[model samples]
Target: MRMAYLILAHDNRAQLDLLIERLLGPGGEDFAVIHADRASPLWPELRASLPEAAGRVHLVADPVAVRWGHSSLVEAIAKLVREAVRLGSEGAHLISGADWPVTPREAIAQTMREGLCHIEVRPGHMEERMQTFRLDTRWLRLDPARDRRAYAATWELRRLARWVDAARNRLGLPRSRPYGLWAYGSGWWSLPADVLAMLDKEMPRLLTSGRLRGTVCSDEHVVPTLVAHAFPERIAAHRRYVDFPAGASSPRMLTAADLPAIASSGAWFARKVDVTHEPDFLTLPDFHPAPMAHPASMRGKLPVSGQA
Candidate 1:
């Protein structure tokens, strides 16, 4: 079961370089597709850093400008999945630039072989909240100030939006139905090739549906929702470690102090690592660069060990 790591990155070139090294190693067969934010200027530096593993590491030809609380994140993910599927990868893991593998390569390979799609399902009420308001309608494009204003405006306008949606539903007017699929969970996942292929084929319809166009954080809902509706049996707990403190809007930046917890979490990866805050963490024995392989031979080949 060949696996593809689809990474979404905007900044932190050094961190991304480290992640690629760990995942691909000198000659590891697993393929990787990196989608750098279109707004970021670090792609050149990122590409230059991986001269040795050019064959296995690919950059998404068309990258999306991802913004927080927006659907562009889903667009970026979809782009990565498309590339991975084209490469004939059997499974694909979605991760971010700040994320690093915590599970051993062998273990991750075993999980992929088992064909589990890792994602978390939210509670019933939370899911309802996500779908209740037409948050996406407020901001149709990526503008930091506009995005922030739209987000802030939602709290004050949610009640009205809900009433409008309810009235439209009762009147049998067109309403956003998210590809006629239910929304659920955090957006990150590791899915089988068949599922990814389905997504690739269906994405055009979803994008055109206008349901998800202006939705805030639709990326968090789109994939899990699709998978849950299409392949419930394949859904598994998302095994990536994240630390969200009470009342915090985002996951906390992981430091060396979190190493013990990270090791014990049984997670395949951990996120939000800052090299400046934890410079020594990257130097740990586990993160040592993999031995270089002969690039000529590894080009366009399936991972030597995990082929299905």
Candidate 2:
């Protein structure tokens, strides 16, 4: 059984470079698929520069540039899932362009074998308070032709996307929570191949559902809601090691101070490490740069933060 690390990339070239190094440094048997955002010119260089350790790496085509909260995010992710299934991986780890692993490769594989990894289900919502979260305003409303790189084109469309999203909330027609099922935020998680295959089948219907149609930030809320509702019994309720704080889609950025937290979190992965801000990463005791070509096998003395 193989786990494919599915990375979604945009213009974060520096970050992407670091992420590839860490993933390959771990050096366990793993495969990867990179979906470089079509909107950026740097993707080609980034793809070309990818190190040799990323065995069987495949980059998806027909690039659609992604806006954080828009439908392009959904489309990009769905496309990856389809490719992961086609690649015949046992499961795929859905990750962002800015993420990195917190745990060793062995631990991650063990969790998967034990079935501790969560399987998501979609939920239903019908409460009055739920009306405020608009699912369709941002990416949900996106028509690829109409929404093409709106963020890069003008300040107005970006502003309009925000304004329209706020208006939807005021009117109480949030794109996602129509049926009142509690939603989960987007972060790193692992799953069985079968679960991903199921997700491939359900993608279209879930996207169009009234409960999810208005969802603006599809990352955190979309998959969790779908998993909870459709396969509640399958989801492993307890989060792995790294966890999102309440109301946060991404985890807090890791800093020098955060290393302690990273160690303790035992999270399979954590991310958004800005090398510029934390340049002394190599000096830290737990810090070790994996050879660029082989990422998964890089291991270090235990992180002090792990004790926290």
Candidate 3:
């Protein structure tokens, strides 16, 4: 099957190039569809550097300005999925520029199919994220640690929003749950070809419903939820090793020091890696040739009680 590596990438040109190179096979049989942030200064440079021969790499036109924990992320992924399908890819492995392959290409290749989605499915709806309107106030978003003035302002706004949401909850006010019976997890997955089409079809509904307008990190929810809604039996575990500390908001960035756990995790991919912080990581012995590992072995690699 011809799979598309549907990557949501921005900045880190060297890091992104390395990710693409590692994912590519010698024959260039599979292709990639990259959606870079329009706001990034390196957008043009990154686009110019990629080898676009034979339509192997399709950089998105009219890119979306993505933000952390925002609906824009959902929009961006939907666009990428539509483009991947249009390019005639049977399925897609949705990932980020910061992720690396955990298993050999051949091993991972065996999982690609038209209707089976490989993803981690958290059992219940992320009620807090969807129940409250996590509105993205279009004001100056500054680093709270560095800019006290902006931080104080945003903090007050956040507090007000939180109070409102709490009052509504206490009052039993109605709320919107766009993707019904939401299934959420880490914002990464491998989607089947049929699932890609479903996601593409569902985008208009999501955008029009306005349910995800203020949902925190809707990317982690929408895809898995919709896939389960349409093809529940085709769902599979998301075999990606992400070292999240218990109760941590984000995964720890991977370095060469974590190579042992990463290699033994029996995962198809690993995430939150950055070559900028540890330049030597890229030069470390490649970890992709590992033997097929059982999904249960991933738990041992975790530093805390969280998703793998």
Best by lDDT: 3
Off by over 4 Å in 3: 52-54, 136-141, 166-172, 275-308
Choose 1 or 3, whichever is better by TM-score: 3
Indicate whether candidate 1 or candidate 3 has the larger lDDT.
Answer: 3
Model 1, 12-98: lDDT tens digits are 665576568667775556888999888787666655554246689888877877777676777788899889889999888898888
The 10 consecutive residues of candidate 2 with the worst lDDT sum are 294-303
Model 3, position 22, has a per-residue lDDT of 60
Pairwise TM-score winner, candidates 1 and 2: 1
lDDT of 3 at 265: 74
Clashes of each: 4, 55, 2
Predicted model with the maximum TM-score: 3
lDDT of 1 at 36: 87
**For candidate 2, what's the RMSD?**
8.1
Tens-place lDDT per residue, model 3, 1-308, is 77789888877776676566566634547888889987886578766777433557788886888877778888898889889878888778889888877676666667674356888777475756766765444443567779878768877777888888888888888576555667777878888777888888997578777777667777788877788778788888788989888998789898778888877777778888865555444554443454323324433432342321
- In candidate 2, what are the lDDT values of residues 11-130, reduced to their tens digit? 556556556655655555567778888778657875567645646567786666876666566777777888888888886788876666666665566677754446333343322223
